[model samples]
Target: MTDTERTPAAATGRKQPFDLGTGPGRVLVWFYGVFTVAAASRSIVQMILDFGKAPLAYVLSAVAALVYGFITYSLVRGGERARRTALVCCAAELAGVLIVGTWTLADPSAFADATVWSDFGRDYLFIPVILPVTGMIWLRRARTA
Candidate 1:
């Protein structure tokens, strides 16, 4: 192909740097995706089976599922804007986890059932708590990459 026809990155002979699909990012995406499915499914079942039992916890679970879904989508999109969006979402996810985790611990009676973030995701091996931190670190590094 002629130089004029070459893509900018190709013309410069520099391969495009990896985004969320490489190395640890790939793992992060997988975790987010899994959480999206898990949280969403759990929330749906809980809402259907026991909506009046723990409305707040169930609603929060649904929200967490949505956040996880968005983060997963952004990571897969793989662009500067996507990375930034994912970073912000990750921060929000972390905050949610911490707040909900503490709330559950402080007043167990408030939640008739556990959310995904209950006790810092004790039901899910604490992955919910750790995932955001890992995602934040990965996003920061990807920004520099």
Candidate 2:
């Protein structure tokens, strides 16, 4: 039998492009999912109730939520296209974290409130900074040869 014929997915006709839902990929998916929800909820509430206080921070949080949601969806999709999309998103997320983190540090007055990426996610234990790096590495390794 061919390689595809030997796998369970092939038997089931699923034809998984790569097994991103297994092992560490699962963990990455979970984290991204949580981040998506957390950021969305936080942004929505802040925008609704206190937008005038920190519009920039709240908007950035909403943007972060969107990115996290897309990355999570891509990871769970389990295809080459999805994987590549997730990889790009993860890189963007990392860059956002670094840029926002540095801005928050360099100019505290610029933001009246904190964002998901502020301080490199110090409020979230720096997960925002670390997760993208982990995701990129996992995605690169998860690619088919």
Candidate 3:
């Protein structure tokens, strides 16, 4: 299959992009899916139990969840449009990580608790910071593949 050619899925006859959900996209899908679940779960639990303690942190985590979920969905639903949307989302996610990471660091007392992007994802091994960059690179390459 070529970049502009889409092959029908065996079971559904739905056309899928030739370049997406293959090698690097597959890895991105996995990581994004995992991050979606992780961020969503953490935010949900924190909001329900201790939102009063750190509302900003919890809300930011939830926002990250929504972003991750959208990107994951876009990756899985491959098409030219989806790829473009995912690339844009990856850029937004990268900005969020950097901004939130710096905010948390500059004013540690700003949050009573840590968000997924806290200290550049210190508790999560900085995957929050790294994943978006990888995703953006893969997405840009996928556009030409």
Candidate 4:
């Protein structure tokens, strides 16, 4: 029998592809894309409005935005190099969240305004805290292919 005919599972939906691009991956990609825009805009507005007030925080905001952008791009590109870049960015994101979260919590006065990493992304319902971990998991899964 042909490959398709040899598999009785074909009678069911088991023959279908995982639909990575259209399903979970699609949601993940969209989330990264939205964060890219949101974080970029936030950094630009903060820097333009009063970067002198907190140069370090503003610069870190920009870095976060860039990382989010890179993650979004890598997810859409879907390849070996892209996977590696995504993995690196995700790890960096995790570090950023942890460091910034601790710093902000320990010294709230240091942060005059909210940042993406502030309060562990409390403003965004902690997605900012959890996204990198999820991204890392997804990146690992993609690597097996």
Best by lDDT: 2
Could you report the Cα RMSD, in angstroms, for every candidate shown? Answer: 2.2, 3.7, 5.5, 4.8
Model 4 over residues 77-117: C-alpha lDDT tens digits? 87677888888999999999999999999999898777898
Clashing pairs in 3: none
- Where does the lowest 10-residue lDDT sum fall in candidate 3? 3-12
Listed in order, each prediction's TM-score against the native is 0.91, 0.89, 0.87, 0.82
Cα misplacement distance, residue 92 of candidate 2 (Å)? 0.4
Which ranges of candidate 3 are over 4 A from the true structure? 1-16
Report the error of model 2 at residue 17, Å.
2.8
Ranking by TM-score: 1, 2, 3, 4
lDDT string for model 2 (27-79, tens) is 99999999999999999999999899999999999999999999999998878
TM-score for candidate 4: 0.82
Query: Which digits, one per residue and each the tens of the lDDT, describe model 1 over residues 1-145?
Result: 9875566875688756657767888898899999999999999999999999999999999999999999999999998889999999999999999999999999999999999999999999999999999999999999877
lDDT for 134 in candidate 2 is 99
Which lDDT value does model 1 have at 18?
55
Q: Who wins the TM-score comparison?
A: 1
Output the better candidate (3/4) by lDDT.
3
Candidate 3: residue 79 Cα off by (Å): 0.7
Model 1 alpha-carbon drift over 4 Å, by segment: 4-18
Question: Candidate 3 local accuracy as lDDT?
Answer: 0.89
lDDT of 1 at 14: 72
